[model samples]
Target: MNTETGVTAQTRPSATSSEGPDAHSAPPTRGQMWRHLGPGIVVAATGVGAGDLVATLIAGSRFGYALLWAAVVGCIVKIALSEGSARYHLATGSTILAGWRSLGKWTSWYFGVYVIIWGFIYGATAMSATALPLTALFPELPLRAWAIIAGIFGFVFVWFNRYETFEIVMKILVGLMFIIMVGLAFLVAPSLPDMARGMTFELPEGSLFYTLGLIGGVGGTITTAAYGYWTQAKGWRGMPWFPMMRVDNALAYIVTGIFVIAMLIVGAELLYSAGIALEDSDKGLLGLSGVLEERFGATIATLFLVGFAATSLSSLLGVWQGMSLFFSDWWYQLRGASEGGHEGSGAYKFYLAWLTFPPMILLFADRPFLLVIIYGAFGALFMPFLAVTLLMLNNSERVPAHARNGVVANLTLAGSAILFVVLAVQQVARLLS
Candidate 1:
């Protein structure tokens, strides 16, 4: 039915594109479950970059699991957001952009400005983050050189590979990263009883912002809205794939929570126990690396850096591909074109190019404070924006009655919006001060 590339359920070229013989053909087998889980995994891996890990580590270092429940809550919020997005796409065959446009022209303009400003700033940030561990791993290369190389590597990889191949590569990267995280957690030997204590619904003194960050910042971003495009790209369309999509989404976030939980334990046992403060940034991860080397050996430090690279590069690839999906679909819809033209289309490549190259100029210059504030405020507010809009869309008559937001979905979305607003307000206050 689409007019752009004229692609349909039957016409998708990827080997894994078919949802199944039919949507409701049968329950997914083990192999089928594995196949359909790509989109959520991409979102989780994308969102949990170095900054997220550092935030969790800082929280654990300072509060010692007093905010542990917040991390679990963060995963739950993301699951709700991911499910709502997937449901909208399958129910309406619509993109999130289209859903926003349904709300009002104001929503459209807001997203346009947000995406332009957010992507320009985030691109440079993502590259610098990726460069950090690589420079640590190979001390000879300056961070700037490593950053540009990281950006180029992400660009070339995503530019050539479609969703299926990209998904496969990311799966491998996350798997390797997972092993490293788990191994580090083991080395730290955190007490399970203390972790249990931390899980209680209690907040530490003066840790309000840290708690809110953990709640609002786990496993989500503007990229979370890209879930639908990934579902479509994965060849799962219509109501039949709905159940499988939910399963896929839930499983992905569960893995995200586990990875993050391991990180918290590392912070608790290593940094908290030792009275170490990482000063709250990606540099904290580097400081953790030095501690790991001091305690375990150089080999341990080297492995962690490798895992860090995997985490960083995985995010870079996801954003490069995920944002391209969003921009391409937006351009297609705005021009009265079909959604089918979106995969690696002109706009797709343009955004991909934007994410990779233009940001490199900022890598060479000093980062501006005003640009950081604008980026920070929007970045902080995005999840709240997403939660609020999803509440409107999924609850509206636009989605199928059966698939619309139920009580649990509504509760989670509402809670996510509130939590994000708290974090957003706090970020604005800090920036202004």
Candidate 2:
């Protein structure tokens, strides 16, 4: 039951037989497994958008190194959830939506409403986020103009490209983002002793919300749920693919952990010691750019802005692609299509258009109050919903006995569910009030 890899009835060949590596004949070597690391990179790039960076920056500005431990713990918690998602897919050779469907019609109802509404709201949000640094860098255009251009760019790119092209572009963007963020952290030269002290568990005064936000916000989003679909897109399909999938998931989040910790270091060394405060929004990253210009110079500030654009655009591209894949699968499954929807399908294009067009209206004017309320309520519950559903699906008989959740996996996922539930309650309360 505890073995790392084995095949079962649920395991099947990839849909496009040429996509995945040949893992069935013999166990893949470390080098071979590393070559197959695409989906995890996609997930990581998609998950860490501009908003996540701002949240971490704010946490570091407010609490210094005090909540560093929470950020690391957040990564671990997400690792558990994402691993469970990929594990179910590999062990059962089914999509997560299919797993949700097996649970009951209630799952479909929740997802159908959630994905559509989430797409509409998040489209505007993602476009605005991607546009910020661009507007900051090139001020001739208004923020709204840059946002629309960004949305169109993402829509065109995803609409025309396949998964292979998408993955390659994502890797390039992720690499650029990694270099810029980690480079800035090094430029600041953080104190080693203070960082070490931050590793010990201690929350400063008035730090509870910031601490929770850090733990909950680091490199996680609905993108975590899209991970299994990504694995399938990469053509990994069974128990034989399990070991490689685990490695990919862990490494991606490890990169995410480093990326987030770098931002925290920037906040701690550059802002906290000086008592600088950043606005608690995506625009706050632009505030950091100003700080960078003052201290480092125009060149470094421009570099930071470019990195910011990379971060934001990568997220926009990822959601446009990954969520569209998810929406297509869910719709086709609901209609009982034997051969499920794929890229370039009608449902897929509809979602891509849906994500790109309808939300553009919100950019021109304020988001409607009622729609905002509904989006917040549903969005807040999504993480908890994912955590809970994974618990039910993975522990039940749908998965093979050998690939079921171990004790550590169970505890970590259970903890994630509780954490997200708390966050959801707070978010809903804040939104309604």
What is the C-alpha lDDT profile of model 2 across 333-352, one tens digit per residue? 67765444577777889999
TM-score of each: 0.92, 0.93
- The stretch of ten residues in a row with the least summed lDDT in candidate 2 is 1-10
lDDT of 2 at 349: 90
Top-lDDT structure, candidate number: 2
Lowest-lDDT window of 10 residues in candidate 1? 9-18
Q: lDDT tens digits, residues 152-264, model 1?
A: 99889888888878888888988988999988999899898998997788987888887887877778688888888787777777787887888889988898999999899
How many clashing residue pairs appear in each of the predictions shown? 0, 0
**lDDT measured at residue 280 in model 1 versus the true structure, 0 to 100:** 69
